[model samples]
Target: MSNFKRASLIFLLAFLALPLAGFGCKQGDLEALRQLKEPVVLQWWGVFDDTDSLKDIIASYRALHPNVAIEYRKLRFEEYEQALLKGWAEGKGPDILFIHNTWVGAYEPRLTPLPPALTLPQLIDPQKGVEKSAAEFRETRTLTAQDIKNNFVPPVRDDVVRNNAVYGLPLSVDTVVLFYNRQLLDQAKLTSPPATWSEVKDAVKALTIQNTDGALLQSGINLGGSANNNRAPDLLSLLMLQTGTTMVNPEGRATFNERLSLDGQAFSPGADALRFYTDFARPTKEVYTWNADLPEAQELFAAGRLGLFLGYAYQLPYLRAQGPKVDIGVAPVPHLNTDATDAGRKQVNFANYWIAAVAKQAENPAVAWDFVLFATRPEQATAYLDRVKRPPALRSLIPRYQNDPDLAPFTAQLFTAQTWYRGKQPAGMDAAFRAMIDAAVDGTRTPEDAVGFGAEQVNQTL
Candidate 1:
């Protein structure tokens, strides 16, 4: 349709939807709808999801408010950011968008914080004798900061809340889990996956296969450097967190390069984590099964050459499709050993997921935010999680998936799962980490020096 016709039709829609599911609304609710007297169209964009996954929820929401119409578009993740940037520059960006949880701070300037209250449709007054009767709605203060903290996991509050206001909300959360080949473990005489990093080291010895010439015939695990493994950053960060390394200080500066007192001795856990990780790739170390010469971690794991692969829950379907014949089993990501030598340490894991947020460009931000609340609430979110086969972020929904073979490990870890790196330069931060991993694995610099240098690089982005 031409621009003029579109504009005229929208004008008519605004007037026709005057009831807007508020025919029996109170005075205040009617006042709230004054600005919304115009047609409210919400354009939502997301990545790695299909329209069918959301069609039912959208239909349910639309059925409540005839005045509001939501149009959802799924974009390729690789091209999503550039598309958003370009469209935003032209004032044509989506009013609603799905962004990685870590991107909250970077994308905050373009987002609108949730309002204190929302005037929403509560019910539709349908009378068989009075066919013209419209729907009814009420104002609600159910989307408070405290409400978010109570309803969702701790990491959701950590990532989505700014100074005091909430900038976004999530429907699901995923954590890194140990994906191991059952056949490989049985061959190595191991009956179960490792429960601690120390066990992982010993298991690597039995699972590794090498010839007298010192050439690797098959690898035990995928770890060490970041060159070919896309998950290298998450794995390394997870290790750092588990070792009690503070990723960023209160001032938002990188502090993973600093030191702390361990057993009355001053040492840098960050550096220790880095050295421990690089040991797997060094020929001199006992856990020397991985090196730069090996194929990408995902590739090696799929071919059954790799014994254990640390990955997020979202990757399970892809791994299954890639290695259809590979018998895969999942276990909780190994934690710091809770033995006599290491006691009272916290259980830490890595979180990687996307969130739903409203744009500042939204013509009616209240309406946009209302949809966000409706979509993330328990009922709608549960339906979404059911369709997606991922872990739910809501505490109430955890039990439903507690026994699910593929989802249990991820859901169980949500209590302590965390994330760092909230800056705008996600790509630059990845490059700095890759460089740090290379220096330590290549013996070009000490692990401590490399970590310090990487921290400085990340500071520039802040």
Candidate 2:
């Protein structure tokens, strides 16, 4: 063969050999090997005691981005604040962290401000099912703002924005509900749950049972451990809000100390709300109940001893599992008579949100943001709600689940639900409120005194 012909044959053979070599190669093997050479490591600190579901989510993310490795550290809710603060001060904090919605005000300075480039009209449009008010407030034009907004519910969107900037995205939304024992109601000859606080008081009076020996057989409602538990500050806060009392000033300062005026009369409504809660446990009223050492509050409700409970929507699954025969029904928490907005509507449920944020000191903020954006996408959020059995945050998800009989009340409350921040000192303020409630319930101080003192304590922190 001529030299040119020989060269052409060689070229053809080389091309054929290339295809043959590729035929034996695994799909994406080359790309996968290349990705393995330079993996990005992300440290994620999460305040989720329930890790199984979070692990599954992380695994899913990893499957999508094999080149990125996520290291997750779970922290208890009570200890997370201190732990995260310490980690941040030491510059050893995770690349991503979970923050409670109310905590954004406290942690905003410590977090990185999302770039303006990410806050574009397309990404920040409220019409896209994000809270228009919040988007306008947060100016959320950052890299994945649209994706994050779309993933979250309107309330979550509202919670993450502060001073016209978006600080984080919510992973979950929680609200309080009245979990009542049908057996207890039926035994008491009650046909329905209390529709108002006065009815709640009367029901509690009827529900209380004492043994012949005078030892308590069953208590009506357990507000908290000795009425001092800080688990439900928002419950009291809601009462204060519904009564037209602002819990905090615009600058995030505690305002519960202010003597609220109504109809030309000065009153401490916060104190009244607190007193009403504590008085239930007063022995004279025969409403005083709850033992910290015995069956937990939930257990009491499940066992048919407790008639009612103030718990979150997330508690439904556990309640159903633990109290299979207890026949339970959920309603919004009962409101004061003066709370027209809440009273005219279903019960008023307090809103709580769990948020996802990128640490200020993250080594790879962009990558961490990408993960946040992906996890908070509307579709992903809906999937998460399904997997976790928690309520969805996005407005669009409401229609999808509106027909759900179990979820209708909760979905309706999300629209007018409220939250409060006790300035930047959440822990201290929470403790003070708990102490105030405890004092009032134990008769050490009246509700008026307790609220005044508690407000002072909270204000001092501001």
Candidate 3:
């Protein structure tokens, strides 16, 4: 071959390889990022909230980055997981999605952990008498794991942060609080709500009214039995935690039924908690108030036949809709006051909420996570919380909502809210918890035996 022809072929090969070599280093180059500055669209999918609820937050983000477009879609809670699975399997899932806190462990593999910081270009200064941007500059914002821990509530750290990486962040966190009948308490001559388990027992005994033939005329507190009780697992979890049970260990093993107390007591707190929970359903117990034959707890409470029911923020609307004139009052969950000085005996409410996360397979993961970070900021989060009227997850905003009469009880519990690890199959673990309570309540097994059985079953799921 001629020398000139050979040289021409080599030049052609070099030209093709130039772009391939540049690809490896382009990600860190600001000029390369600025070159690909076309509008990028993101699809966001969520559950239990309509797009209108997030419209203001979305607009706030858009004002920061005009070139980014977000399309928000709301999915039904019952059908959300299957739809997400199908979409992801087909390589067409959302760039951002809402994940329940309990399911974070199961969904971690599909979610993109936020980076240490984000760098994006934004308009810096507008010309005088002009509404258009005159200058643009890159802005860098950083969020460390410590920042998340310091800014958000305790359970958010426990649920969202894994291995020093944040899996997601929530706009709000809801906790289970006591909902009691005002007229029933007034009828019983009790003006104040119960503040401790012993007080609850006393109140229940006073409020419960049984007819001559042993039929329950008015139930005390709708607890103990699993089937009819609302949020029975969460209630039981709160009991276990307050009684000094570690629901799961760092290794993701179910150790709730077998742990010693924080003071190193040689007793199973889970067993004790379970017994305390199921006592109200036992016929022989003085605290007996509910049974398996009773109607659903919410229905009974709404109909004004029940005294107290434990529920979260979401249950308020349902209860109001069911019986507007029921005259209900909300309070913090009662604690175990066996030792007043023992901080561990304080009230521990259950934290449950949805967190927004970026999909690992997202075309622009950085931008997706950036949007999430932007939305969860204090201002944007406040707007979202105002629309939802749920509990605030941020520590700074808790005090502001504390003065709100309707939200005070929930907001007060946010600092102390806790949740147990339910593993990959959270629903199945909760079912085991319910079964444990039911078995103990029915006298099929002793509390100790039931707790051990439930722990063993929950460990399998983990």
Work out the TM-score per prediction.
Answer: 0.88, 0.79, 0.86
Error of 1 at 37 (Å): 8.6
Tell me the spans in candidate 2 whose CA falls farther than 4 Å from its real position.
Answer: 1-37, 49-51, 55-64, 85-92, 118-158, 224-230, 289-295, 337-340, 343-348
The alpha-carbon lDDT assigned to residue 435 of candidate 2 equals 81
Once model 2 is optimally superposed onto the true structure by TM-score, how far is the C-alpha of residue 405 displaced, in angstroms?
4.5
Q: Show the colliding residue pairs in model 3.
A: none
Better of 1 and 3 by TM-score: 1
For 1-462, candidate 3 gives per-residue lDDT tens digits of 899999999999999999988764444443434523568899999988788889999998877666788999998888999999999999989999999899988888999998887765443442231133333345576677888899999999989988899999999999888899999999999988888889899999999999898888899897789888857888888888887788888788998878464556678888989999999999899989998788999999989999988888877878889988899899887777744211354656778899999999899988898899889989999999888788899999998799887789999888788887778888888899999998998789999999999999998889
* Global lDDT scores for all candidate models: 0.84, 0.69, 0.85
lDDT of 2 by residue, 1-462 (tens): 999999999999999899778754633443334434357898888765356656666777777655678888888877887898898789888888888787787788788755555321121332343222122212343444554456555566556766666788765577777788888888888888876777887888778887776555777766635433335577667766666666778876676757866679988767767767667656676565554443667776767778888777777787888888888888766776635345334334578777788888888776787777777666677667767766667766777665566666566677667777645666777788778867876678877777778878988776
Question: Candidate 1 at residue 416, lDDT?
Answer: 82
Tally clashes: model 3.
0
Best by TM-score: 1
* Candidate 1, pairs of clashing residues: none
